[model samples]
Target: MTYGPDTVSASQPLLQLRSLSHSYGSVQALHGIDLDIAGNEFFALLGPSGCGKSTLLRSIAGFETPAHGEILLDGEPLTALPAHRRPVNMMFQSYALFPHLSVEKNVAYGLEAEGRGKAEVRRRVGEALETIGLTKFAKRRPGQLSGGQRQRVALARAIVKRPRLLLLDEPLSALDRKVRAEMQLELKRLQHEAGMTFVVVTHDQEEAMSMADRVAVLNAGRLEQVDTPVALYAAPRTRFVADFIGTANLLDGTAAAGGILLDNGLVIAADHTLPSGAAATAVVRPEDVALAGAGTGTLSGTVVDTFFLGGTSTVSVQVPGLSAPFTCTVRAVQVPQRGSQVGLVIDAARTVAVEDDRAASRPGAAQETVSS
Candidate 1:
């Protein structure tokens, strides 16, 4: 199952994108995107709709040619190669499977088209089906299988090709919520077992955070930030990333001695290196905001509402001098009554300070070194 080296050297990346850009007529789809993905790593391209994540995936798959830049696989350039000529396999969101073909035939279709011998095709197909745990259902057609099973069949077909890289475009979007969750783990397991490099394009922040070793966030055809899920969530370098990654209570202010100074003269202590008087934003997570007795913490606020979510409750507090309500996730058992005054204790160490300018942030400017 293992394919390449378990550990990739820092000197070289398996897939390299340099000044990559593409456009359709006057509509620019991709900016100068620079990225490096190591072998045997599960990387995700994450962004909202029309962010060029899909376009980037298609560029790598050889389906869309870029207007400029070079794509390198291993050490060779892949720009001149056709989609079929490249050593890459892409699985679409639809789980495109032949309805008339049995599981075995479907899995073997690529090999058969490659002119591989019947014996070799059968051997590879059997191994693939076994790896996917679908040996018992090899004779069944795509229509006979459940959503998850059909997804597995598509996975088996893609992996049977043993391509150097596997690209998935919202692979689990077709499944229900429960099944999508299951397949997330399944996809990770398969990637590890097969020792293949996986590049998944997704708009789901939770999905990318849960599955990828590293994620690259794109915005308006521009690369925003690229880092590990933990670093990306905990220490976003820009305002757009802070807002997009998860639920962050963004406080816009000016940089001060040790934190960001709000317009109301309250300085929220956070970690940052910005010069004093510069524009900044404090990124605070809901979980890090603790509710305390009024006048006991940094800021006092009135509880606007409370949403019970099983083990946790999200409390919205309306504070003076703030434009929007600040949200805090607290234990459901300690739910505070609405209209009650409460103090907000934001953890200084967990809170991050990011630049407020949306257009100035680059992909790797403030990112920590992430392993493949």
Candidate 2:
């Protein structure tokens, strides 16, 4: 499926950041961040609160100045331009619609401020309303519109200017769960139709994975990983990335000849190139774990809990040496009873071994990736 505009050039990036860094008093909010965004790609900045995603977005939108680094748009320096002068628009989470103005007028506000002629403003306003599917509601005020409709109006206003770049700060956080889901699809469709580059900041992992062509995960004011959603989930580069992007069972162990040797003397076979005796983590997903009859798999454990989730059930198994229970996803009909002894069969091929981040901090330590 196409995740971005149809005609994007591969040679040159539309936006570039060179060692971007920002600080708040003594605390650093953004480390030296370097990123590139294609012309019409939908990119997401994802992380937990205080990860500096919002600061990065604000820096790009000219709302905040970076302490170090340069911002470039289409290879043009943008550090000197003020927010109002830059050819970019930001959609705030609040939807910021004027209560007194009609829908068409709200969308036309930017064009009017630019001193466009009356005929031109009328033409653009009509087209913008039609683009957002609000043409019939042009006469109504923001107070009369639904939350979703107000969001669409805000989107219309942002795109009506035909800015070179569009920034969204948690645009869907204000909507309910159902409406938020519906709007995620709507946002993708709108991006494709508008054919403009979009950069969204969100703390929700699902939202970022669903809508963005590529995602940059941030942690503690630094970028953990930047990749496509599939790659980010399947082959996370760091322990932080593996844990943050999805639900992963991180088995801490020492790297042996061909696998990770857990403290309990269980050697989980995995594909990795780490040096022998190095600290490593085995990343396993719940779906890759299978529950077999006792003594028939790698390790045996007692089922402590079972959670039924419609088509599937999650069985939490309490092993002897592990502090946290190992979770396995099985078909609802195949769920075993609690307290039943079962063997945990891990899929070796699907497993990944990543160097422990803590180990990397030690002197003379190195990091390695899982081999194919």
Candidate 3:
């Protein structure tokens, strides 16, 4: 599910944004960012709102001009090309379908603009409709289609052009949960069949992590990290990234000679090196945390609440000296009881250590990283 340095190479990048910088008046939207998207790979630009993922997507689509750096497609400079002239098509979040146009006409619009003949246009439109499994709905207008159907129409239109790259800007955000899940698989299948590169922009971690071949995480206006979903989840390069991508139990402590010393007088062994006395956060995932009966665990806590969700159970534990409650996930059959005292056992080999950075660096992150 994840690839390391041994599996990925930098030999060729289909789309490269080199030292890309963009601004609006006095506000900078993107900083000196550099990225490479491999050819035929489904790459995602993922982050919270105002993080500039959408701005970067538009810049790649030729909608926004960068103040500095270059946008290259297949090693060819595309910085100067206009949106319509570039071999790229974007499917907006809204589906952007013309209310009066039928599915077939919508899919054929791009071919018509490109001046394709009647026969070829019909053929491509039919193929595109079939590809998205919307051939039966070709005669229906936008108003007559469901959210997922409209999304398929937008996708068909974009792919009908056979563009070098497809840009999807939160294309599945408008759909319901069940529909969104189905669309995710459909999008992945379409990408494989087309064998074209795809660049997606989304704020949903689940969406990006589930469908992308690789994900590029953006913070503020800078690129924080880029790696496969599993790699990003397993070995985050920075604290912000570690906390942002997935649910992490971050315990702040002082780096001592042996490992890290928690404010609670607990010491946790770390695999990574850190200067003694340096401020750091020990990153642990809930699934990796084990609960033991009192006196049998490294740390002691009382169960405050428990939630049973079919396959997994989440238990919130209240520990003294910690700013907030910590949560851990276990098998549904292994649920913990509220008000019961339990010991916290963490897997040192599976843990990671990151230097604590500024606040607001990782959106939705809990403040006050672990305490003594």
Candidate 4:
């Protein structure tokens, strides 16, 4: 297929970072990060608050200099280019709009700085506003717009100059849930329309999963895994990824011929082979845990907590000897009442085992995705 500049796909990278590393004093923020973005790809750098997602984005944007590594755009090294000289634009989480300027003026700011003729600026600004469905609000200031509208104004400003790449830092964090959902669709459309690479840094897992073609997960200044959201969720290579990307229940047990045998007299069949005497932890999502009749199941427990979410319910069961309660996510209609006796059943094919290297046991080992 033809790539950028009416050339073949083998021409060059749209954006490339080679062995990028950054540090603040003695604390390292990013360590040897290598990534590439093809033309028009929507990529996300996702991790928790201190994982340095934002730091990496800033480094790529020229806001921060890396102690090592190189940054390239359109196959050209960007080592010597300043932020203003590089063909890149950033939309900050705060929607950094000029409160005093009208929406049209804000959108035209970059074009004006480039000394474009007035008529050309008008044409580009008009088109940008129309593309974002803000043509009528062009005369309004940022103070007159809602959070979502202001965000749109910022995006229009960034894309009006036709930058080669766009960087967004938590661009949707300020909007309400409904507005955020609407803007997500808008951002996707905008990316396709501009036909430019869009790299976003977010702590929100669902946001990253919904908008990105690929996600690069980081933790404590290190790259964990880079893959599509489905693959990251389905087959996490490390225990941290398995626990961080979704709600999971980790059951510590002794390795056996079939699987790992729990201290509670329960055995989980896993896919990987482990030393017969090794201690392993079984990772299973709450949604995979099924409830059955007490006398006909693998393990039995007492229902202690039930959350009646719309269309579904999350129930937590207390089992003896386990440090924390085991939770099961089931349809609201399929759950039993609180204080009732219940049986927990796990599907053999869905569970995986990881070696537990920390303290032998801990209470409430249930894991959750980031962006909370």
Candidate 5:
């Protein structure tokens, strides 16, 4: 399989970062981040605010120079290249469309800067507008279009340049939920059709999970885990990833003979043998724990709350051993009333053991491939 320039594949590294580190005075932002972004992949850098996700994206875009690192795009060192000289384009959070210019002119801005022939610019701009489904809106100005349309115009402008890599910083943060959802699919379609690598930096977990092929979860300037959304959710590698990726019941426990012994002395069967008597935590997803009729299961708790969410409802059960009530997902039809007793049967096969890394857990919160 030929890669780079002609056709790209998962085995081909289009963008690679090695020993990337950045700091702001005494505060370290990124600490030795190494990533290999495959060709034509939709990759996401996810983390909360101030976790250096933005800093990392900026470094790749040549906006912020890293304290130490190297960025290579298709085997070419990009760290030394200026933002304008690099074969990349960054669509900022604000869209940054020129309100005074027509949509066609806005889309033609990048080509015009490079001094392309007028006819060539027009042809490329027309193709980009058509690709982004904005051909009819070409004559309209930014203020004349809706929020989503304006975003498309900005995207058209970026793609018109035919950059090898596109860096989008908070690409959908400004749109409403419905528009954001629509744009998510649209972005995926656009990326697939274009066959260009996209590195999206986002704090929205839902956006990242729903859009990208793989997600790199970051926290406090450190790499937490890089995996597919399903793996990140079902098999988190650390406590921080478990807490940030999805709703998790982190029950403090001690590693003992059979399993991790909870505060109430209940043992949750674990797949790995932990250091005996070491302090640990059991990470359990809400959907993984099943609640049944009381006295018919291995564990029991009193229903503290029930959240009705269309097809499924979450049941929060207050157990004596767990600090926070364990949440179990049940069909909306099976939601029990609050204050009712229920039994929780955990599927041991779904549970994974990892180090108790709560110190990395903090409220912080992007896409890849058509298929690999």
Candidate 6:
């Protein structure tokens, strides 16, 4: 279900942002950043609010000029170019459709503005409508179309110009969950058929993970890490990334010989290079943990809660000396009842060791170098 980074060359990704830094007056929004977006790829900028992912996207789209560094498209500098002059189109969160204009007219608006002949505009508009599966709704005004149809119209409008790169800012946020999932597939299909690079900015990890070829996670205006969704979830390079990307039981620990020594008196065997006694956190995802009988596991805990999610039940077990409960997914038949004592067993090979979260990287502090 996961894909690798685009085959586009890193040296000449369709778009690139180098050493970009921006601020809103005194409050800095983005730190020095470098990123590459391959052509014909679906790339995502993912992070929590206030992390500057949006600012980075806006900078590339020419909505906000960075205070430092350059924007490059196919090796050409774009920092000085006006947004309209650039070979990029942004589909805003609102869909920004003209209610009075029919879908076909709306899709042709951009081409018409550029003085594209009626024949060329008509041919492209028809193709884009067909591509987005909105050909049947071409004569329908925005007000008459469904939410999903409006989204398709917006996409069709944006791509009708055949821009070198498409910038989408929460393009699916407006739709309901069911429709959102459907649109995710549609968007992926559209991107492949259009053969244009897509740079989407979203805070939703699931959205980014499900849609993008590669994702860049940002924190405190700096990049945390950038990789395929599988790599980011399976092998996070930093503590923040391991915590933010997905559900992780981050146990405070110290690096010791052949393993990490948890503060709770349990040693989880892991391969790490950090010197012994150095601060560390053992990153254990719930799926990698198993619940066993009281005396047969790595650590003992009492089941505090169980949640049934169809095929799996998530059991929350409270361990001694820990403030929060350890969460693990168990098979429906293997779930323990509340108040039952159980032991926790983690898959050591699946566990990752990273620096402790207490020593987080801040804007003015030295940060671990994250690959882009």
lDDT of each: 0.90, 0.88, 0.84, 0.82, 0.83, 0.86
The digit string of per-residue lDDT tens for model 6 on 1-372 reads: 111134457666778789998877666778889988887789999998777888888888888899999999888999999888888889999999898899999999999999999899988898888788778888999999889999999988888887888899989999999999999988998888888888999888999999999999998788889999999999998889998998998888899988889776778888899889999988889999988889678778899999999999899999887778999998998988899999898899998998775565475333332211
- The alpha-carbon lDDT assigned to residue 337 of candidate 2 equals 97
lDDT of 3 by residue, 236-276 (tens): 87787988998988888878765678998888777778888
* Tens digits of lDDT, candidate 4, 313-370: 9999988778888988999999898888888888778887877655544222222222
lDDT tens digits, residue span 156-229, model 5: 88877878889999999999999999999999888887778889999999999999999999877778899999
Which 10-residue window of candidate 6 scores lowest in summed lDDT? 363-372
- Residue 60 of candidate 5: its Cα lDDT? 94
Q: Rank the candidates by lDDT, best first.
A: 1, 2, 6, 3, 5, 4
Off by over 4 Å in 4: 1-12, 253-258, 261-265, 273-280, 355-372
Worst 10 residues of 1 by lDDT: 363-372
For candidate 5, list the clashing residue pairs, or say none.
42-367, 42-368, 47-365, 48-364, 48-365, 203-365, 212-367, 212-368, 213-368
Give the 10-residue window scoring lowest on summed lDDT in candidate 4.
363-372
Could you give me the TM-score of model 1 versus the true structure? 0.94
**Candidate 6: misplaced stretches above 4 Å?**
1-11, 364-372
Span of 10 residues, lowest total lDDT, candidate 2? 363-372
Off by over 4 Å in 2: 1-8, 359-372
Q: Alpha-carbon error at 176 in model 4, in Å?
A: 2.0
Give residue 66's error in model 4 in angstroms.
Answer: 0.5
What total of clashing residue pairs does each candidate reach? 0, 0, 2, 0, 9, 0
Error of 1 at 165 (Å): 0.2
The prediction achieving the highest lDDT against the true structure is 1
C-alpha TM-score for every candidate: 0.94, 0.94, 0.92, 0.89, 0.93, 0.94
Q: Listing every candidate in turn, what is its Cα RMSD in Å to the true structure after a full C-alpha superposition?
A: 4.5, 5.1, 5.6, 4.6, 5.0, 4.1
Give lDDT tens digits, candidate 2, residues 65-122.
9999999988899988999998889999998999999999999999999999999999
